[model samples]
Target chain A: MTRSAVSHADLTTLSAHKVRAAIREGAYGGHTAGLAAGKLQCNLAILPERYALDFLRFCQRNPKPCPIVGVSDTGNPHLPTLGSNIDIRTDVSKYRVFRNGALSEEISDISQVWADDLVTVALGCSFTFENALLRHQIPVRHIEDGKNVPMFRTNIDLVPAGQFSGKMVVTMRPIPQAQVAQAKEISSRFPQAHGAPIATGDPAQIGIADLSRPDWGDGVQIREGEVPVYWACGVTPQNVLLDAGLPLCITHSPGHMLIADVAEDAETTILTTP
Target chain B: MTRSAVSHADLTTLSAHKVRAAIREGAYGGHTAGLAAGKLQCNLAILPERYALDFLRFCQRNPKPCPIVGVSDTGNPHLPTLGSNIDIRTDVSKYRVFRNGALSEEISDISQVWADDLVTVALGCSFTFENALLRHQIPVRHIEDGKNVPMFRTNIDLVPAGQFSGKMVVTMRPIPQAQVAQAKEISSRFPQAHGAPIATGDPAQIGIADLSRPDWGDGVQIREGEVPVYWACGVTPQNVLLDAGLPLCITHSPGHMLIADVAEDAETTILTTP
Candidate 1:
């Protein structure tokens, strides 16, 4: 399908599978913040099997920032449990190839680099909760601004496992003081999507120095009566994986993600079966 | 520290650290239910570092049956984050030692058998939720009768990883018809302690044949107007590890546990730091 065939505005009406097919066919290579509606979109982190368990533990240890949404079997690109016909190698619009913890290349497909020892881990993203917040009539400033959510690295140290360890990265959202509690209540139900806010009020408390200049994404203006709320961001795993100095790791670029078949609020405790 | 000096009734008021101390000193060699009220009591699984990652993955894949509360570093006997001075080798009242996936001995302490490559995993238990249920004025039949909770092996296929895989083991609790919703709400808050029920109303749905003859623990009578609710039990990891045929494995004997310093209702996410 051509870019004109599936217009940017019409992307929202398309099913997740169609969107993935477009991405696989190299038709779309843009952010997927609101494309899949109510479906769960996941941040991708594919690593060698040698590092898979340790990385899984890192997510388990720091679930606030790195909630495990779906994990594929080692060497298998198909996340069958998470989505029908989901191919981790080429489903995402764009991919970042990290070699020895450094960005080596940008690619649209990882089929050539896929190895039998590789494992794909899909972590729940803020988009899931953002949708829930929107459903509850809570304003999401980033979505409203049509910009990527501002993310910052904090002093909060992630519990390390093996070689995967680093400071947590958090996404900031400005919420009116009145809706902060309601926002938390709505988002807490989506624990697979980083759950509730990790910190509210001053970003300085969590070691974030400036609101104007973020480490990642675009900064949003905090209104007079609004407090800067922070939720653990999925970028955490990507940041840690880069720092982990692994020989090879592949992750979804910025807003590109693997759209899952799961409902945003599906019970995270029992999503898998073997 | 004589056993007679620390009466079972007096145990309830003791602090978790103190209770662990008494157990370490050989003063307490019995079940740990009601002893550490409000504090989290964890089911222990100690395995070699070789099997640690796969087991951790199994737990991650099957969180409902194996909610990870604490994981000790490789070869580390102390779980400093979970408690002030938790020595996995000697803390629990009783331990079941498995060799080649079969029970070889039941011992009070594992110091003699402890190895340098061993790792300790602490899984959240139903006792935490049971305490919450009782506090909410919900009846817990097992606690009422001073009997062990009924546990059954279900047909639920656990998400497998590496050499670890098995069916889930669930504990049954009969909730009154009117309070089932309330019971679910209260229990849902304790995700670290298996969260909400996996199945309710029927035993046959999950493939349990007989409620009276449970695979583990004592069977409780399902009274009139009460529906049988099943929560993923901690025994799942044990069952899986046994089936994995690992060279060495150790687990807390039924009813014995490692009392953690964390509050049962403490935030499940963001629990650890390096």
Candidate 2:
């Protein structure tokens, strides 16, 4: 938990600030899964101010896949609401650079490509709900295998806004048939974390033809008695944005997220029943 | 419920499309209170395309006070997502024009002032929850009095986004002491409609001094054994944007709202508990 260079194995017990400090100091370079245990972690998308508005609209229109946790002011790298001294350029452990709709580079720091017109968008990641599922005795497949959650490009076309448009991308988890309801109920508590499963039992229903092959991230085994459950993924925005072929776009590498200081409860659309 | 130039007294039984037709044909010119019962109603805000992003971000950050139900594309009058063939230009019964942050004109139709760069935003209104409250046998002071719900500017500062910033505005309803919990529970189910009460019992806590005076709508009576309950109002954005001094901004006049084809459940953040 110390600010000293820490290994990925020790990240789960650390505070969000400590984890980010380690990442900033170049001490950690792994995916943020299970890190900063109960704190909010986000998917990052940095783009020009011009596309920021439309992108924001896209998020607004499709909130389940694009729950905005925090947004930085134009040309500002600091996200004060998410955490103090949270520099967007250096805090994330890994960054994906896209140019003209193609993967151009993978880097640990974006300080070199930072621009005044760039806007930082922090979206809710599935870490919260994954943690919730774990707490409820529901197993998460990718986490158990120490791999990134399997992601697939689906045929579900996102509601377009301005020039931003694309099919939705989803992350799959293998949930035992008996635990699916418990998983759904628990995950539904965190809408910012993509809420509950959009599809269960059949991956082909949402256009994923293969179980072992994924468009992004590592694929996990779906065992007997387990249903392949799909939740709208955070990688969706990045996938859609990349396909838009913008002159420039940057996002957190899949599974490598930005740790935020706020609790999951701080900014939730809490649905409660009487 | 028939759409043949229906009177306000008979409007509640009609569908959203019928209600919009009535308004579009210049038949309904009154506040939309109690109309289109059981359906979603929205507070409308029309502004130049330039300010839409900041305003949307403002809504993103402060969701309880500014839950957006539908947003029109730049220069597009149609909101197909909210309803079929719902034209933004003339569907609402009344429109308030703001010029450089000042109230300038109150008109029946905005077609004369509509421009290609203008964007229409529809936010959740309290009519849905008020109907819920009434159906639950809880008396709504404003509805019982046949007046617009009393609205007040609060001391609570909203989270700022871009050029949009201001204190939240809230509507006050005096609920009987015993039913306040039930009212809160019922209202919590409709986050698109300003969610649950932000404050109850004392108006002075939120900077309101007198119960007989409201900044916007008519004041209602608080009887013995009743407490004034408040919910974040849709007027906060209109109030803030008006204070921002935009050259041309239009909004639904106080108590008059746009009837959307969507149900209250369609666009909600949908908070749920196991």
Candidate 3:
């Protein structure tokens, strides 16, 4: 069960470059939450060029869920703008391989399957915004309880692009009713990190009949006086891509992400390389 | 030359739907600045499906310059999501037809060249953000001077996507140096409208050689104690599409835009049909 003697806590102290280097060398294959400290962590998707265009469109059309921080050139594995010395093939804790729209296997390194037409997409994760919420004294239930953010498939239809189409999926956090607006403002600052909650009160309005049972990730407690606030989740793209039954697809394991060198700063406004 | 009895200002008083109807009937072909009042005005690009995928990727990669508001399905002229009864063939003030990357001719309607493989791309215009600036009491030099906003070709190299690549084009507005930060915050609220100024003060930093001689549009004076603030322009995609010398391309004539039904509001975060 124990893959490394060095803990994730130790990885947090190291620079993002070092953390990525360790991952690339097969030394670290653990969840990336809170790792790389202040830098932005990204959810990863690797698809062939045939699906890349459509997938990119889907992300653009649905910005909140799939805020793209970096996209690698077709057949190229390095994300030069996202981080220094970045290599998509071997810099993740684990990659979930999908074939014909089904989970086929799990692997730590995807170098064996890397292809000339492969394209890598890096989407913003909620970790950055969650950190912001914590700093502002707002509760991120799952992080406090040590579980994945609860995600549900909703009746809300996403704007379809090409062969990719699916129902919108949202991650739910129960925020105190009074603090909902504050949470919205804080998260809104990071547009790349799934900015702001889409809906705040009843889940039934979005067609989520059950709050405890999520379609993806683990569920968390909704303390009294707190209401469920939903933000579009990164899993929506993966869900849609799987439904397309692409010949092959790969995504980072939940919570395990690519730690890019991009800092959470004022420069997000005038991003040139993104 | 007077083409119609109605002035551009006269049309601005009409609803967006009525304006599109008038343009569809070949009644008006002037610029669309301030038209539709509160609605989002859009720059237009129509291309064959063969080039659409790349073009879409190009917009997503360089979001600031080519902020996409709506896109039509291939060969479909109706932008159902942008406005009611919207027909790309005849909705705008004028259409500039390009052949092999060179300007071929100008027309009010594009029905003669309508093809099933054509895809329409709607980009966000600066008008929305300009209105925002005015509302916040910030100076928009061109507006005050009754001239087109000065636009320059910048040295900033946009992130290349597929076969689409080009330098960044910027629209310059002179703001009192003290209000630069205020302008940035106000415009930042409208991400769909190119978000915020990419740079301020030194035009040479982004490679604009002369403020008075703009590559496109009319220039306004930079008064004493005022600084030139530059924003990523919607003209960027058109420039790249032209440079590619594609076999066919159609765009909204400068200052002539497609009027869409989207309102400037909080819903930009949970964009449903964008």
Candidate 4:
């Protein structure tokens, strides 16, 4: 099996586990943006056990950007709460290795670098709720334009936890002026998936001086009749981790996610098993 | 002003600040159950700054029980988040002073015992949502019967945060079988007021051995055709704080509360001045 072989296969028809197995076998190393439909995909963060407590506290303090779905036991490569066979070392399609707050390497596997005191934290991603929005007939401009969602660093400071402290990052989506309330109502139900919009209308109020130029991801064009809505972005935790300047940290490359067995709309509860 | 004088002057109809002034002046020491209607009522938690961070973490972890509305800055007896002129040491109708986890005094004021290193936390109470339930024509059995809502210590352990770890405590209300969905919908709106019920159905499943006998509040009769619904109780935080054995702690006496400027039905935001 190879990366091209998996790509050649029916991408949307594969189960999450099958797709993960293919990724683990060096058969796939592509973005997981729309791969496994109806499955819960997660943003990954792996840090040393020493910072686990503080990181956990940080997630608790700021749930909008970091709704924790699963936490791997200390030094354990397998995540029991996300999926039964998830091996954090190889399950992700691609991994971004960070050292002292800077990206050092991009790899297909972290098996050789796995340490005995590493802890993996899986955060709920916006993709799940974005799918829900699309299902409800909400227009997602970025998806239609075939570009990554526009993201911005905001003046809104996330509640600081221990040594982890930074401003919140947000993703923007332009909604038809009349659909703003409906959009908020639908998204508010998914607190695990960034909940409701943090700000709307004037982006400058939140310190975003330019909507045409985002700090991360490709910027989307806002139509004349549309309003830009801001949601806390998953990039927040990653940014905070980088700012902390940890000796070693690992995260999934942007747009690459860990697809879990849990359904996208599954009731939010602590999973009894992986 | 004397208690009778304050009561006769329609002081209860005054704003939260004026009502609190009456309480501060030793004019009112009665239960705050129905006074200052439409205002947010909070349960109090005062502890030394050393334990404040851990307690905040605990509240963040177990939000269903400790839905934090306001947290005072270190040694600042005022809760600016809740209301202007809201002094924690004297605003509540009554205060229960605890020393080494044991109840040491029940007083109307704690000014003499206030410390420079103490942190005050104002948590949401069920009264806010119970009013909503009643407004929606939902019957609150305990309130109808003029009895205390039954509370039980469950076997469900809260996610531990530092030194604060204990079993969850819940309050029970019997709702009509058909109104379970309605109850859940209405209560879910008040996340700061414990959101929705943690469990609904046979109480034994969550480790409640007897429904007629409660560990804390007076047990009310469960009428025929009604199903028992349990909600995470505000008492859980106080109990957990007691169990932590801090050198000194202060909380509002049961039924007494610290009324705030925020409306009970107000939609809350992370930056809603709190």
The CAPRI category of model 1 is acceptable
Order the candidates by DockQ, highest first.
Answer: 1, 2, 3, 4
Best by lDDT: 1
lDDT of 1 by residue, A1-274 (tens): 6754455576888888899988888788777877878888999999998887678767777888888777777788988668888888889988999999899999989999999999888888988888888888888898899788999999988888888888989999999899999999888888788888988988789998899899989988888899888999999989999998899999999888888777777776233542
- Between the candidate structures 3 and 4, which one is better when assessed by DockQ? 3
Top TM-score hit: 1
* Model 2 DockQ, alpha carbons vs. true complex: 0.40
In the order shown, the candidates' Cα RMSDs to the true structure are: 2.2, 4.0, 2.8, 4.6
Tell me, by DockQ, which candidate is best: 1
Model 4 clash pairs are A2-A27, A3-A27, A80-A274, A83-A274, A84-A274
The deviation in Å at residue B159 for candidate 4 is 4.6
Which portions of model 2 show Cα errors greater than 4 Å?
A1-4, A267-274, B1-4, B135-138, B176-182, B267-274
Q: Report the C-alpha lDDT of model 1 over B73-153, residue by residue, as the tens digit.
A: 778898766777678898999999999989999999999999999988889999888988999999999989978889999
lDDT of 3 by residue, B62-115 (tens): 878887777777787887667778889988878999999999999988999889
Better of 3 and 4 by TM-score: 3
Which pairs clash in model 3?
Answer: B75-B116
Per-candidate interface DockQ score: 0.42, 0.40, 0.35, 0.14
TM-score of each: 0.94, 0.91, 0.93, 0.79
